[model samples]
Target: MGKILRAIKKIIPEPIFDFFSPVYHWILSLLAAVIYWFPSRRGRMKVIGVTGTSGKTTTVEFLYRIFTDAGFKTASLSGLWFRISDKSEPNLLKMTMPGRFRVHRFLYEAKKAGAEYVFIEVTSEGIKQYRHKFIKFYAAILTNLSEEHLEAHGGFENYRRAKGETRI
Candidate 1:
């Protein structure tokens, strides 16, 4: 599946690819949620979405520490790592907010692993791509917003709007 998608990306023209990107992202997000049995909607854990141009990783790490210190089972997904309780691995993908399948699968795994809470470091790019669509967030934290990714987002207002959609 991955190879096929990669091939398609290689073949498509940039303009066409950009035009259909949103639809593709939305479909994948819905499909991923269905495949994962909509983990976030199952009420298995409190999913907190942290969004901002900066400070998202730091905030997620701090929350993870606080929750773990208090003896709560917690999972956190950040730019730096993917952690479930005491077990963790480096985020080699380099995507702060990965694709929909990854996000949904992570939530499903965290829930199955007995996580009481899950903290996800949300990014504007992720939201713009519909990666944050199906997840039902228990809470949302906006650390701060600034002019970042201006070209990719078209402008600061668009970036801010994307950040605003991190929850729900």
Candidate 2:
């Protein structure tokens, strides 16, 4: 599946792909929300987003413990792994951020499990690919800026802007 997808991507003109990327993601995000009923719609769960060049997974893990210890049910999505309340697992997707549907699905599970907070590790690449779409974040913590994902974002400044978008 991955191989085929990559081949298809390679066939598309870069400019055309770039132009449609946002629209593709936006439609999927919205479609996923509609099918799943947008778990964040009720406003009961607060998503705490963590984005940066490094240490995002660690930060999310730390915040998860804090929230859990403080008696709030916590869920988290990190590059290293993900957790739903007390349950946890390794991140098998390889992608630091999961795709549009998985994101909403995770939130649905969290909401169903009565999670009060979900801390996510946001990435510049993830944002560019629209993996950060649709979630209503209560707060965003930016650890720092670096020259990471420069090629993906086209330059350092663009990289920073992509990371910064998580705050919005």
Backbone N/Cα/C clashes per model: 0, 0
Instruction: Candidate 1: list runs displaced more than 4 Å.
Output: 1-17
For model 2, residues 34-118, the per-residue Cα lDDT tens digits are 7778887676899988988988888998999998999999999987777998899899998778877888898899999999999
Candidate 2 residue 166 Cα shift, in angstroms, is: 1.2
- Every candidate's lDDT: 0.92, 0.84
The C-alpha TM-scores of every prediction are: 0.90, 0.91
Clashing pairs in 2: none
At residue 31, give the lDDT of candidate 2.
85
Candidate 1 lDDT (Cα, whole model)?
0.92
Query: In angstroms, how far off is 36's CA in candidate 2?
Result: 1.9
